[model samples]
Target: MTTPVLEARGLSRAFGHVLALDDADFEVYPGEVTALIGDNGAGKSTLVKALSGNLAVDSGEIKFAGEPIQLTSPTQASALGIETVYQDLALAPHLDPVQNMYLGRELMRGGLGGAVGLMNVNEMRSQSRVAFDELGATVRSLTTPVGSMSGGQRQAVAIARAVHWANKVVFLDEPTAALGVRQTKNVLETIRRVRDKGIAVVFISHSMPHVMEVSDRVQVLRLGHRAAVLDAKHTNMEELVGLMTGASTKGAA
Candidate 1:
């Protein structure tokens, strides 16, 4: 078996009197899509946050590439090549695609222009275009504010940005939520493209059809812990629902 690119063993987190995660175990391998499915308050968000360095775990171990590491901050996670796209799709409404792609990391020209704080707009635009094209994201106008773009287009930009910066794994939270049929199709296609490039994708959503349609494996969370992990091909919706609802504890091979 391939070593998991990201793994969490006995992960736990608490918020005041609430336990958001309780010994949650999870893993995602390279070049495959892993669906993270659970009902409300199942600890999916808490687990993702701990793995992505947005939130520290109360007790557990996170292994990356067979070595243990501390995820103290999102920047630390980014440095280790892990990226997350939250459900909110945190893109700047007033900025264009190219600008949004770079955000705080805009390339600056060398010498005088660099000292004068001039951004290398042309270079950034060229690379942003390549990233979008590589991800097959159709952004008709690269110069328009992303807020004005369609939902599908905005989602594409978010995924492309995450993939561009992430070399190992990318966590996507409810990527297709509230999207129309055509838009969801486009987003799912982009996800496949990302996986084909050898990055592990952690897809978290409540949509069973989408989970079955796009995932190679399904990891179900119940209450505050992982209920089971099953091969997507060998599992059915009823079984998944059973696991999530604690009606069944047996896991599929």
Candidate 2:
């Protein structure tokens, strides 16, 4: 086994008396997609929030690249090469693909010519195009506003943006939740491309078939705890559903 690119041990979080995550343990490797599957209130949200620095962990340790680290905020996580794409997409509807891709991380023209804080439009466009091309994203027009693009196209842009800035792990929350069949396939392929680029993908989804198809491993959360981790190829939907619902106690083989 190889060292995990990202890992959490004994991760716990609480909302008043409710224990969201209870001594949870999770890990994902580079070049692989680890599907996080569970019923509602299974603590998947808490676990991911802790790892992504959206929520503080009550008791746990997060290690990145074999070193102990503290992710106190989303910016801190991003600084450490962690990027998350939420279900809402967090995109500007009025902005074009390039505009959305470089939203907050826009490049500023440097040197004496950059004294006035001019935006580096051409350079940003070039880089965005390269990222889209690399991921095989299907965007009809980079100049078109993101709101006008199809859901799949917007998803592609979101993913491309994440891939461009991500150096280690990318957390994708229900990436294909609102897509059609073809769009879902496109997003799934884009995910594979991300993995091919050697970035670990933490995919959260309720779709069993999607998980089984895209993930190298599946981690099931149950009642605020780590239920089981199964090899996707060897495990079937029945076994995974069983584990998630507390019908089984089997861990990864």
Candidate 3:
């Protein structure tokens, strides 16, 4: 069998007296969308923070591409080609799509200009356009501030930014939180496209219907522990909800 692109074994984390995650196990395969679904305070966010290197686990093992690794910070995770798109989208309200995409990692000009720390605006703009286009993002005017775009468009830009730099996996936390029906559909499509491109996608959401529709596999977190990992197609909503609420464990794959 082919090794998983990303895996976590016996992961645990705590905040003072509260045990956020307890011996959690997770895996994300290439070209697949693995949905991490659970109720609020079920350690979904904690696990995400740990995986994305925002929070350190008290005990666990993380392997990326079959190699053991440690991620102490978000910068370390990003350097390992792991990108995260949080619920807020994390775009500069005043900046345009191109500018937001190249926020911290800007291109520098060659020779004397590079030595002086001059940004290569033209190159950054061109590359951002290509990345957005590849993600099928609808940015009619790349020059307009991202704050002015619709919720769906902003979500698309955030996803594009992750996929642009992430060679390993993309962790999306509540990507379709407050959007309308149409906007939610658009964002979900973008997510599927991201997975189709052969990058592993860890989709964290509360919407069970959306999870069922988009995920190839579903990992249920209940009380900081993995209750079940089931095939998305074979599992029903009732089974998922039951597992999450500590009522059922019939389906564990």
Candidate 4:
């Protein structure tokens, strides 16, 4: 079998005396979307923080591409080809899509020693459009500020940025939250496109129907522990809900 793109074994995290996450195991395969579902306070956010290198793990191991790695910071995670799109869809409201997409990792031209080093604005604008197109996003122009775009458009831009830059895995937190029906459909389709690109995706959401529609597998967390892991094809929403609520066993009923 091929090695998973990302894996966590016995992963745990704590804050003072509170155990935010117990020993949790997860695997994300290439070209698949794995949904992480749980109720509020189930440690979903905590696990994401640890996996994305925003919080330190108290124990367990994290392996990326079959190699053990210590992710000390978000930069380390990004360097390892892991990108995260938080619930807020972190984008500068005042910046255009092209500018927001190339915010931190801007492309530049010219030699390191010369003053010729300048932001390649044209290249970024052109490439950003291509990425958006690949995701089936009908972004009319990349010059519109993010704040002026619709909620779905903003989410699309955020996802496009991750897919365009990250080579390994992408973590999406509550990606479709607060989106209208049409907008939600658009974001979900974009996610499917990302998975089809052979990049592993960790989709975190509380909506069972959405999870069932897009995920290949589902991992349920309850009270800081992994309550169950099941094939999405074999599980129903009731079973998943039971698992997340800690009413069902690991394999669900």
Taken over the whole model, the C-alpha lDDT of each candidate is 0.91, 0.89, 0.89, 0.87
For each candidate, what TM-score against the reference? 0.96, 0.96, 0.95, 0.94
Candidate 1 Cα lDDT to native: 0.91
Q: Give the Cα error of residue 227 in candidate 3, in Å.
A: 0.3
- Residue 25 lDDT (model 2): 89
**Could you tell me which 10 consecutive residues in candidate 2 have the lowest summed lDDT?**
244-253
Q: Which candidate is the best by lDDT?
A: 1
RMSD of each: 1.4, 1.4, 1.4, 1.9
Q: What lDDT tens digits, residue by residue, belong to model 2 across residues 76-149?
A: 88888899998888899999999999887888899866788788999999988998999888878889999998
Off by over 4 Å in 2: 251-253
For residues 1-253, what per-residue lDDT tens digits would candidate 3 score against the true structure? 5699989998999899998898998889999999999888999999988888998899999998889899899989998889999989899989999888988898999999999999999999999989988877877778999999988888888889999999879999998887788878877888888898888899999999999999999999988989899999998999999998888876453
Worst 10 residues of 3 by lDDT: 244-253
Alpha carbon deviation, residue 156, candidate 1 (Å): 1.2
Candidate 4 regions off by >4 Å? 111-117, 251-253
| Clashing residue pairs for model 4 | none
For candidate 4, the 10 contiguous residues with the lowest summed lDDT are: 109-118
Instruction: Supply candidate 1's per-residue lDDT for 107.
Output: 97
Model 4 C-alpha lDDT versus the unseen true structure: 0.87
lDDT of 1 by residue, 96-191 (tens): 999989987889999999999999999999999999888778888899999999888899889889999999999999999978998788878878
Error of 3 at 223 (Å): 0.5
